[model samples]
Target: MDLFSLKGKRALVTGGTHGLGMAMAEGLAVAGAELIITGTTPTKMDDALSYYKRKGFKAYGYLFDVTNEKVAKENISKITKEIGEIHILVNNAGIIKRELAITMPVEDFRRVIEVDLVGPFIMSQLVAKQMIDRKEGKIINICSMMSELGRNSVSAYAAAKGGLKMLTQNLATEWAKYNIQVNGIGPGYFATSQTEPIRVDGHPFNEFIINRTPAARWGNPEDLAGAAVFLASKASDFVNGQVIYVDGGILATIGKPSNED
Candidate 1:
């Protein structure tokens, strides 16, 4: 059991105030790591920080935008200088805009790409430099089921995620000898604020997901906990450049609606 522990580790997660990022933060916290979660809003960060502090968990929050390379570098550097080096990083900040390619504005597409793809690249590069000097670290990128397959009106999101998958591999290839493990989590549809609109529209989406997935259900955020902990802990010392999908068997299926349940 202790083999999966992250005791004495310090972790940083971007966009960690809500949804999968928040879930990942909690998972790391429960695994005994001190957590620093970043977001753009002070209120949300404060709320998350307050909750963890009240729970007697070691947690903090910073208002920073990962898309801003200058701020990302400055704040992260400040954090390491003040609190100690962050041994783990979860690149979980991202955005999506749904529109047909023909009608999609180039600016909107670029916005998604900037936040989703470019932001992670910069964050990983900056953090990997620190990790390289230390010769040990864990970096987890939050990819999406889109990394494997695309859906309608989300070409930019798919493209960004797909790029992230390869980026994870590339980073692992270059940094493995330095003792850094770079991996990604490609999540399927999970119940979160970001997905609440679709979930509330109910039947069509639920039916589609249940029939599509062999597991016959939508995933919850908690479903990703063990994977995050494993990748962050010493247990994954040999794991690198991998994208683990937590999609309730959605990715494993073909065209058939497997109603095994």
Candidate 2:
């Protein structure tokens, strides 16, 4: 139980303002880690901070574009200076542009890669430097189901996430000796605002997801908290370079035919 306590630790979560990122960050906070939230949107930052305050967790917010190496470096340095050393970092900030591969603009593809893949690399490298010096840290990359499976109209996203999966392994291989554990969390179709309209009963996508998953349901955001906390805590000190798929058993089996059940 003590292995899971994050007291005396500071966590920096990129894109901690909303969605799955916010969910994981809140989990760490609940485990006793002070949060350093980073986002590009002021409104979201404000709202998130207010929510966290209401929940009685210590948290700070920063604004930055994670894809910008210089800006990320600056913000990391500033946060280290202002908040204290960041003992944990969650590379959760990302963007996805869904479009047919044949027609997807190169620039759009590049942007998705930049945000989803390159951004994690930059953030991890910057944070890992300090973690290396301290000889201890935790880094979590928010990966996706697309890291292993492909879907229509998401070529860029799949590419970025796939690359991110590999990045997680490579980073873990390099940094494990330094006592910094790097891992990833791959989430499945979830009941989020972005998916609300598509999640209603009888919606084609919703129906597909319910049937596709072995657990017969879309994942709840809360489903991710336990995994996030485990990977961020000392409980996982010996665990590195793995991507825990918190996907309602979606990745574990071949799907039953839609007509069978």
Evaluated with TM-score, which candidate comes out highest?
2
lDDT of each: 0.90, 0.94
Error of 2 at 82 (Å): 0.5
Candidate 2 residues lying further than 4 Å off, grouped into runs, are none
> Which is the leading candidate under lDDT?
2
Pairs clashing within candidate 1: none
At residue 178, candidate 1 shows an lDDT of: 97
lDDT of 2 at 199: 90
lDDT of 2 by residue, 1-261 (tens): 999999999999999999988899899999999999999999999999999999999999999999999999999999999989999999999998888999999999999999999999999999999999999999999999999999999999999999999999999999999999999999998888899999988899899999999989888888898999999999999999999999999899889999876
Off by over 4 Å in 1: 200-202, 258-261
Candidate 1 lDDT, 77-194, residue by residue in tens: 8998878888999999999999999999999999999999999999999998989999999999999999999799999999999999999999999999999999999888888876
Superposition TM-score, candidate 2 onto the true structure: 0.98
lDDT minimum window of 10 residues, candidate 2: 214-223
